[model samples]
Target: MITFAVLFIAAFCAGVQNALAGGGSFLTFPALMLTGLDARAANITSTVALFPGQITTGFAGRKNISDLPQLSFKALFIISLIGGVLGAILLLITPVSVFEFLVPWLVLFATLVFLWGSFFRKIHENPKPLGPLKAIMAQFAISIYGGYFGGGIGILMLAALTIAGLDVRTAGATKNVLGGVMNASAVLIFLFSSDVAWTQVMVASIASIAGGQVGAYALKRVNEKRLRICIIILGFGLAIGLFLKAHGS
Candidate 1:
């Protein structure tokens, strides 16, 4: 009961965070770990559990999705799918001990990325545009990282897409779609893995969906900047805690 409660609350908050800004994994991953899952299992379970919400969010923004002149959305989609599969395969073959050691560092790196995207990226008024080939390469790399860990993939995608010449609005919607595509591939692979905790996935999924709905409704009313700041603080705190735990272990 307590485990379900924890997962429900964590996933609920994660969904809201994801709907508003992205970084749901930051919440879900740690919550899964607290439920006694190893780092690798926690990551797999979190990825699997959060997938439905991602798809829904992406679908909701579908009308706003657009293709770039240099790279069609279809091409990007294919690259994301391929990269995601490769990354998932890599994760499955990685030894548990090594993944455990890597988790803290991954979380820290993701937190830093989130921090930069949220705060610093805005400081630069104009971002240099990426050529089609460079954009494709960047998206492929981001998709692989998305499948492997997926802490700040949304922000990463948004940056890349905007630099690829899409406006902020179009880039945001396109990234959401691409994020779902990549994660869909990863989730398909995770479904066959023994690492997934289906019960936790069920609990978290339902809660997250509900939270996403609430977040969608609250989007116009809430102060998004403040919300982003709070999430960043929470991310840093979680990263620090994970580092301490890893050291103790």
Candidate 2:
């Protein structure tokens, strides 16, 4: 009962974080790991568990989505799918020990990226348009990372879209949609794998979906800045915890 409750609460906050910013995995991944799953399995399970929320948020924001002039949504989706597939394959083959060791660093890196996102967005507020090739390659790279870890991919995508000439509003909506696409691609691969905890996935999925709705409605009342700061702190704390776990074992 306690485990389920914790998973539900973690996923609820994760959904809130994803909806408000983009660090849901910082909560969900560690929460799963705490349930005695190995790092790789936890990561994959978290990906699967949180996927429905991504789809829900994406569809909710679909009408606001705009196409990038340099890269159409269809092209971007294709590139992201291919990248996500490759990344999932790579993750599947990675040794459990190696993945465990990498988790802390990955969380730390993603946290830093999340912290720098607003500054980067400010810098790219009026960026010169990216070339088509550059934009495609960038999106593909981001998609690969998204499939691999997926903590802060939304912010990364938003920054890329902004630099590629999309306005902030359109870029945010595009990020939401593309995030869902890449995650869906990865989730399909994970579904065939044996690493998932289906019960946990189901619980977290329902909780996250409900939480996403709550997050959307709470936007007016919640202080985003404080929420972001809390997420950042949690990310660092989780990274430290994982690092110790990796070293102690």
Candidate 3:
């Protein structure tokens, strides 16, 4: 009963944070890991459970989402799909010890990229000739990282989208959609091969959707910049902690 209550609160926070800034895993994953769960299991569980929050956020923002300039969902899906498949395969084949060592560096890099991401948005406001391709490449590359470690992926995706000439809100939306793809793929793979706590997923998913609907709707009335900044700080601070923990363990 306590775990259910805790997960419900966490999912609500995650849904709101994800809708505004795209880094809800900063809350969910660590919370799961703290429960004596193994990292792989926790990663899969967090992604699967929080996925509905993202979907709800996406759907709630349909007015804004549908109005965004021509994005090739087909093309985006292809890159995300291929990347997710390869990432899952790589996860199965790779050694945990090796990935364990690399996790700190990955988190640290994502933090720095997000910190200095203003340059990418301001200077590269418009994509050069092959901008869309670059965006796809960025998403493809990050999908592997998301699959492998599942931390700070929102920061990575937002940074990549900035580099590809997207404003923050658009980048946030695109990041959410891509995340849904990577997570859905990863979840399917995990379901087929591993034991998943479906009860947990159900609990978290319902909580997340309710929270996400509220959060996405609030975007219409709230101060977005302040909210986004709060999310970024939470994300970066958590990333730093994850980095330290990665090396500590």
Per-model CA lDDT versus the true structure = 0.76, 0.74, 0.68
Question: Worst 10-residue stretch by lDDT in candidate 1?
Answer: 215-224
Sort the predicted structures by TM-score, highest score first.
3, 1, 2
> In candidate 3, where is summed lDDT lowest over 10 consecutive residues?
62-71
lDDT of 1 by residue, 53-113 (tens): 8777777767778888688999999999999988788788875454446656655665576
Regions of model 3 farther than 4 Å from truth: 34-36, 66-73, 119-130, 219-224
How far off is residue 5 in model 1, in Å?
A: 1.1
lDDT head-to-head 2 vs 3, winner: 2
Question: Model 2, 80-136: lDDT tens per residue?
Answer: 888888777778876556555666776677567556653445864664687899989
In model 1, the clashing pairs are none
Q: How many Å off is the CA of 94 in candidate 3?
A: 3.0
Cα deviation in Å at residue 215, candidate 1? 3.7
Q: Candidate 1: global Cα-lDDT? A: 0.76
- lDDT top scorer: 1
Candidate order, lDDT descending: 1, 2, 3
